[model samples]
Target chain A: MMIKLEQLVPRPLKDRLSARPSDIWNTTLTLEPGNIVKIKAPSGSGKTTLIHIIYKLRQDYDGSVYFDERPLPAIVENELAIVRQTQMAVVFQDLRLFPNLTARENIDLKRILQTPLYDAEKIDEMAERLGVKHILEQQAGICSYGEQQRIAIIRSLIQPFSWLIMDEPFSHLDNNNTRLAASLIAEECKKRGAGLLVTDLDEDSNFDYTHRYQL
Target chain B: MRIQILTTRIDINFERAMRSLNTLLKKLIRTATGRKRFVMAFIGLSVAMLLILSAVQIQVDYNDLLNSKTNQDSIANFLVVNKVLTDRNLGATSLNDSEIADLKRQGFVEAVGLLTPSRFKASIQSASDRFPFFTDIAFESVPNDFIDVVSKDWHWDESSRFVPIIAPNMFLDFYNFQFSFSQNLPQLTQTVVKMIVFKINVYTPNGIMTLNGKVVGFSDRISSLLVPQEFMNWGNSRFANAANAKPSRAILRTKDPGNPTLVSYLKEKGLATDADKTRFSRYRHIVDLVVKIAWVTGLLMFLFAMVIFTLFIQLTIASCKEEIILLVTLGASPGQLRHFLVRQFFPVNVLIVLISMIMITGLQYGAHIWLARQNVYLDTWLGPTTFIAAAAILGLIWAVNRVTIRKYIRLSTN
Candidate 1:
């Protein structure tokens, strides 16, 4: 599925964005399926806001977002859940995991949220690759920021999705862990022929991106 | 065939996955926080349901006892009704035609037969000197339907040699217990009395006339000497009298003599009947009072229980508000959450209903056994109406749970 943003600007950042030109904020952009897209921005640039807008979480925006041909707001609540479960996945910048749940449980919840897109054993596989396997049984609340970020990345990859949205997914990770987590995400996206939209502070060689935009 | 096998395997996997998911949801939504309140609500609901269902069962059992053929012999369905004899209306105690019509119009009265009294003076004497007895007597005749004795010889015509009579069993008891001992006469059995022939003398304006009368049957329903309606009509018309006297009493056929409405109707109309027959109405009134008390208290308790349950649900949902929002954000649909909450709460209601039903069944069976010793047979099982009431209450609980869950889940999600 392709995500099309039409002249989008966050209401909170509308005035700030008018002072500077952006390649994405006020412009129409379509992230086609199977293409790895990178959005680079400084802090307070509405990068997370843009992701929330596309994810249909925050509707306080000026313009419309479409999943393929259907407008975001046109999808009802249950249909939106289906889209989130099967068509679109996300790793929030805050790493939104149930704090009381163990890291493994947090990821397993997503895996079983719809159908079993991957076997239950796959959680261990992804956790092991990202080097967070030892902390998988630890509660997300007590886990270190870096460990929780890797757990969040594994959670996003555990489900079936055509578009994976990440907002600063590696902010808490070290360089080595970031590369490992990035490779795992790239591999999962490549295996499903799914698109990736990652927002971060600066340009980095995470994956060979088909398009890069300043948000 | 290969595709079908694959589909079945997928279905099994899906089922397993959903089971795990539900377990996780149960862990997250900790309904155990208000355990005390839940237990209290459960107990309240059980007691309420018990009261309500027992009321239904008691009514069913009472009806069965009154109308069941096995208990019919103990209770009389026919009653001889009359106006209460008061000094002011001493000679005017006879019921008017309109009063009889009004009695017929009552829903509880199945049939009314006016007791037509003989207008002329009459006397009865034994035909043989072996039992020489003579007494001034009056005869009353009622319609054939109101007669309880099934005697084939109870019909009369102009050519008949003897008039058939039905003496009240009370009179026989009076004679056997009191009259015979006091007068030094032999106590006669019913068969011996039936075999005796007697002379009936009717005094007319012209002269005295004599006819033969034979006792054909004995009745326990009406407490009077009953003759055939044909004889009474013929005797009253041929013998000289002032005019046809209005009927002072009437026999009523009712399905349930214990009905309170019939009793109240009798009192309201200034009519009277054999108090022994209508004594069942007093017990009925008590049962009615008990049943009504059970109903009102049970319904009030049920309402309070529902309120407690709804508040408990709201409290649980409120406490987990943040978690629910995050869960929804993580793609748990409102439908899923609602289903999970329903599973959490609704099974206990079903269990309560089932437990109440079983208790009522046990009580009914016990009642049946206990009352059976008293010769009042009741069903060993509960009536269909009781089951229907239980199912209706279960359905109502389910609907309430569904609506409460939906409302709270939606509130938290939004």
Candidate 2:
């Protein structure tokens, strides 16, 4: 109900090699709910730059991003936070799962913040489907790298979002991990109907052909 | 059609920066050394404030009462007694015969005493109504309205036309008392019920005041003798020697003044009740300063404590900055996060206050026994109820004002 920021715009394609936070921001791309789109870019090649711009963190550069189809020339921090709450979900490269918290607690935060939770069974089923049910009771920090990565995706997947962004979520994984992580993330996105944006994985990477696109 | 694979409640992405203060309070409370350190620090501050403020009050009250510039009357300098030491009906009204014998054997007291207020008729004339008149001239004003608290002076309309309760030093009775009710007169007998009154020798309208108030005391006015104790006793003897039945007033003396150390020695013996102590001789000015300092010091200390507490909360949320960023991405509103944090940190200080206040109060209650004296007790004399209320209210207001979780919310959104 609360509209925070409504516009964001990226600078013209100039120099294209500047390292400032604002220089790399891309234009506002409003994906429909559950619209799964991938922004493919090499590591450190500005894939995250696009995510940062859409999320309202790269305020120093060029171009405008819009919220609700309106122009957001620059999104301030507080408004960005509200935007993040209602319309965004992110899968970070480092698997930002709270190490101290258990898988249940990590999931519980999502439900706890919502009015009446989305559904406890959904979390159980998601964990089971991802083969993380065995380690669901364990501390995320102590979990194996693959397990941590899965749990991070699971936590992000459960949120109600208008946009979902992944920052090289599967870059370091072996071929097996890359495929498993992508398939699992794709399935959850299709179920929720939130826009999906992914980066870092190459053509040979295990990603859905329909959603992949180079930045 | 772009197809999202997983579910999400987030609308937008966000990043938050966390920085906290007062981190050590947590670690401090959890361990024995830390807990003891804080408690000791609290008590030390309390004691410092109490002693310094009280010493100043004693110094001030001394100047006012004595008009003496020397003004630094310590508790030991005066023979103070509780105006109501025997009035509370504390069940210790009359000592058992054995107890009396024990006290008598102590040899320090020439006698033990009691008195009741007796009123019939008396006349007084003042050179000028300009001089203030008090209802009970013996005691000063109570500090709080609706709360009978002791202070330097009562600001009442001394407009009433009654024999203002006999002042210990002022006004002139110019009359002598034949004390019949006294058990012992330093110059006479003890264990007597015969009534008498002390005649006041006032130099008013007149020349010099020569009475040192040795014949009068705390019980002197509250006795059945409306007349001055000295006046009544001497007058009674005169009337009896002269064969007269119409003695104008009654007087009773509980102890003999043969030993000047009677009042101080009795008080030390625990004869005074909490409510009974009406005056302190530590320079009225000094006492005033002491009480004021006690109040002001307490107020400021609590204020400082509150700010520190609030900083602790801000620090806690700051520690969780990254988690905050993640939550925002999960579609949790800024209000929701704040609402949760508010719920989280509010009780931290609340717990501290609850536990600390209880312990402080218990300690004060125990310390009050020492505080129950006419002069310079605890640097200030506060009743248990008043003390508790002050501590609670101070803690509450401080807790409420110092919280700044809203700042964390702003930073996170930023």
TM-score for each predicted model, relative to the true structure: 0.94, 0.50
Looking at candidate 2, what is the lDDT of residue B194?
A: 16
Worst 10 contiguous positions by lDDT, candidate 1 chain B: B66-75
Candidate 2, superposed: residue stretches over 4 Å from native: A1-14, A17-30, A70-83, A172-183, A204-213, B1-282, B307-345, B351-402, B408-414
B249-333 per-residue lDDT for model 1 (tens digits): 9988998988899999999988888787888788888877887888788888888888988888888898888888888898988
In model 1, which runs have C-alpha deviations exceeding 4 angstroms? B72-76, B203-209, B258-260, B279-284, B370-378
lDDT of 2 by residue, B69-107 (tens): 233332222222332344564533444445445555655
lDDT of candidate 2 at residue B243, scale 0 to 100: 39
Error of 2 at A168 (Å): 2.7
Best-performing candidate as measured by DockQ: 1
Calculate the i-RMS of every candidate, to one decimal place. 0.8, 10.2
For model 1, what is the error of residue B172's alpha carbon versus the real structure, in angstroms, after optimal superposition?
Answer: 1.1
lDDT of 2 at B99: 46
Task: Give the alpha-carbon lDDT of every model.
Answer: 0.89, 0.47
Backbone clash count for every predicted candidate, in the order shown: 0, 119
Model 1 chain A: weakest 10-residue lDDT segment is: A48-57
